[model samples]
Target: MKILRAEEEEALSEALRVLSEGGLVGFPTETFYGLGADPFNPAAIERLYEVKRRRRDKPVLLLLGDREEVGRLVEEIPPVAELLMEHFWPGPLTIVFRARTDIPPWLTAETGTVALRVSSHPLARDLPRLFRGPVTGTSANLSEEPPARTAEEVAHYFPEIDLILDGGPCPGEKPSTLVSVVSERVELLRPGAVPWEKIEKLLKSFS
Candidate 1:
């Protein structure tokens, strides 16, 4: 087990290196520790599912640096979704969009929509940027296990992970709000760190 300083570029590089080589790396996010692997790599995604004992029907979130990166992964970025992105990105908000042809089934869980988030946590944001492509951003724990709040917790849950980037405890003991943006409006699927009232306000402002 190894703990990488979140701010250090070497740590990010090392994690990315392992991911590029199809290895799993557990890292911190604003919501919880996430087990990361190359989003485009089907084998790596499968390995991630194996590590977490994740359900094939449940989809994984794709973390990116900014809107442009998000745009690249999805089929279309609706105007309302853009407004939400402008306010809530680099934070705990996930917008689900239709997947592009390039997105893998492992990512969307055989669904046409892909879940995406631009995290606020520096290391969480940096890890995805380092990869320069999306990495699977599901919580680091076995299926039905509590989501890990610290890297040590992640290590305990996923002992076989190639590397564990311990970035201390997450900001809050909660997950990101998830919304589907494929229709004329944004629909909240899961209530999380970002409350439904706040999302509703954002939608009203955009409308």
Candidate 2:
């Protein structure tokens, strides 16, 4: 495992290289340090599950570079999801959508849905954009443990990580609010950085 400053000229390329080859990279997100794996690489995802001690039954969420990338994941964006993405994307909100049939079941834990977010963290957002694909956004820590707030914490948790882009300490706040727009009833899977009351108000605006 190696720690590289996030601003280092080679950090982005190195991360892309590791991810492309189905290796893991530890990077900072708006809320915490997360493990970056090629969302398209099932083998890498399996490794991620093992590294984090995360259960395979719980689907992993993905981080996107931007709002437009949603097309690559979902078949149709619900009207509510559209509005939420307009207001909350590139921030701390993860919206769940009915994934494209072609998306491997392993990625979604056979749930047939995928959770995605566009992070506001500069380095975090750039990683996926440069990778040209979604990156696993699961926090870098053993499952059921507090999420790691610093790159060092991530390294300590998993010493075998391929690369770690240290973006310094994260906000260390509540994680992104997770809501599902897969059906007419918008469901709140996790209440977090984006308040549910605020989102409920937005849902009311849906005409």
Candidate 3:
């Protein structure tokens, strides 16, 4: 794994090039570094699973730089999801929605729903927009291992990756809260940086 400081446009462009070529990249997100790959590239996604030793049954999430990218993946954005996106997107909330049938089959595994987030971290957020598509947002770590907060740590864990965009150290907070809106109701899958209480309160106001 090569560690390239993401201090210049040149580095980001090269990272994008790697992504375009279906190679893996480690990028800094608000909570931790996320491994990036073209969501449409099945071979790349399989390689990611092999590298992380992650089970194929556990689906990975997609990182978006723009909300418009959402239309390209999900079958529909339920009202609850739209409301949550309005309030918590570009932050730390990852909302899972029913995937469109045309979306890459490998992305949703057996869940048939795709987890999506509009990241606030500059690099993580910008990469998708630059590439004009979503990127896999799985934490850059081996399965069951703690997520990496620094580029060096990512390098330590993954030597099989194509590149690591070293955006210094991440904020290293709790990882993003994960929720699902695919069942016609909001369900909390993982409570994290975004407190469940706050999400409950907001939904309560409308209910």
What lDDT tens digits, residue by residue, belong to model 1 across residues 163-187? 8887888865668999998894888
**Candidates 2 and 3, the one with greater lDDT:** 3
| lDDT (CA) per prediction | 0.84, 0.90, 0.91
Lowest lDDT 10-residue stretch of candidate 2: 198-207
Model 1 TM-score (2 dp): 0.95
Give TM per candidate. Answer: 0.95, 0.97, 0.97
Better of 1 and 3 by TM-score: 3
**Model 1 ranges with Cα > 4 A deviation:** none
Candidate 2: list runs displaced more than 4 Å.
none
lDDT order of candidates, top first: 3, 2, 1
- What stretches of model 3 exceed 4 Å from their correct place? none
What is the C-alpha lDDT profile of model 2 across 1-207, one tens digit per residue? 888999999989999999999999999998889899998888999999999988889999999999899998998898788888898888989989999999999899999999999999998899899988899998888999989999889988999989999999998889889899889468999999999999888878775
On lDDT, the leading prediction is: 3
Task: State the lDDT of candidate 3 residue by residue for 1-207, as single tens digits.
Answer: 567889875888999999999899999999999999997888899999999999988889999988878888899988898889999989999999999988776889877889999999988988998898889999999999999999889999998899999999998879999999999799999988999999999999988
lDDT for residue 122 in candidate 3, whole number 0-100: 86
Root-mean-square deviation (CA) per prediction: 1.4, 1.0, 0.9
